[model samples]
Structure formats: structure tokens, C-alpha cells
Target: MNNQFKDWKSNLDRFFGHDFWGDFEGMMKPSIPYINMYQYDNEVLCYVSIPGMNHPKDIEVFVDHATLTLKGKIEINHRGGHQIKAEIADGTFERTIDLPFPVRSDKIDATYKNGLLIVQLHRYISDHTRQNPVQIRHLEDE
Candidate 1:
């Protein structure tokens, strides 16, 4: 009975094609780099993991008011061997992260070292947060 089950499963897999379930699972998920973020009273720090890149220039970092964007490609050298298994992803990818507070564009720093990209951002205070009084007009007075 166990052998019959195995044969039946093998036949089903063969009919569907090689790695059909794997391909379907990959399609159902979005690939993105892993990241860690830290927020301080007046600053924000972000750490992104990106391996197999030759140079820091391979990645592009963008900062908006409260969002950070990372775009890059990860390349893996096969080194002339038959690949029996592959789990690591290697390709062009873009990921955006939302920050807790708006950051100052001028006060931003980024460094790539040991396959990790570190970003330091200073918080910015917007004018809208300041105390502003609204004038109330009396129509009867007019």
C-alpha cells in the first residue's frame, strides 16, 4: 500500500512537470531582502542583508519622507559544477520600507560592509506639527 502511494504521487508529479509545486509556491510569494530597523528618539537605523554582490555600487538606496527603497542584484557564481540543489535567490530585486517618522534627506548616511547595508537617518520635524492658531470669523459682526 505504501509503495502504491509513492508510485501514485510520483506519477502525479511527473504529469504536472518537474518542480511544478515549487514553481507555483515561488510564484505565490514575493522575493525581497531581509532587513532590520531601529528607531531612536531623534534618529533611525536600518540594516539590510544582501549577499553575493561584488560591489556596493550594485545596490541603490532611496529615501523619501517616511519611506526607504532598496534596489539591487545578487549574483552567485556556480563555479562549473552540476547544480543539484538551489535555495538561495539570485536576481534583481527592489524593496521599500516604511519609517516611523519622516527623515531629513540631507542628514542620511549609508554604508555597505560584510554583505550588510547599514543606513543612518536623522529625524526631521515638519512645520505642520508646530502650534498654529486658526482664525474664527463672526458672520454677525460683519
Candidate 2:
């Protein structure tokens, strides 16, 4: 039937345009850096792949008890010339990662090599500060 055909065409269009290769957000959002995290017995290692970002001071890395933040800007200067297209992202980017467990903020270390940023964080056992349930009392008891 025509109705079934229309539904099939719409689904195909949606899949090809937005869902395929994650183009839904790709068209709107700038390209972001790729990262991978690994956890060990006493430390956590993170690798960030950000090409075209060379300056050390341009990137800032921070770690808290349960979070790691990475902020940086990628600038690609094009000399006076005609440009057809550019897919490389060149702008400020900030990415925050939630750690699985508490980490020692003071023992965090980072290094950049071959356009890859490596971050190492030492783990520490700390008292969790999660919300605790409170007991409710009746008005007559007080």
C-alpha cells in the first residue's frame, strides 16, 4: 500500500541522513577529540588523541576526587589561499570524565607525545560522601 511505502521511505531517509555514521550531531557539533581510559589496581591511565594540538600550555588537565577534566583549543591557521573544505575541528574543547573510583588528585600526571596526551592518576580509598537516608519522626513523638 502507499501508506506502507511512505513509512518505509521515511525510515530510509532518516537512517541515511542522520543515523548513519552519527551525522545527526556531526552536522551541528564540532569535531571532538577521542579518548580511552584504563584502570589498574592502584592507578588509572587515560589516553587522549588530539591531532593538530601541539602547544603544552594550550591544553589544561585537571583531576578531582572523582572527575577528570580536559580543556584545550585547537587552532589551524590557513595561509592566504582558496580553501575548498576543512573537516578538522579548530576551536575550544572541554571534556570531563567521571572516574569509577576516587583518585588521589595530588598524584595526577600528564604528558603529551606525538599528539597524544597521556594522563596517569593514582587511586586512593576515601570515605564516600554519597547521600544518606534520614529517619522521619512523627509529630506526636517530638
Q: Which portions of model 2 show Cα errors greater than 4 Å?
A: 1-31, 127-142
Q: Please give the CA lDDT of all the candidate structures.
A: 0.87, 0.80
lDDT of 2 by residue, 35-130 (tens): 889999888899988777767788989887889888898777678999799877667889888987889877888899888899999887656854
Model 1 agreement with the true structure over 13-123: per-residue lDDT tens digits: 799978655676679675667788999998999988888878999999999999999999877877888999977777889988899998999999999899889999998
- Clashing residue pairs, candidate 1? none
Backbone clashes for every candidate come to: 0, 0
TM-score of 1: 0.69
The total of clashing pairs for model 2 equals 0
Candidate 1 local distance difference test against the native = 0.87
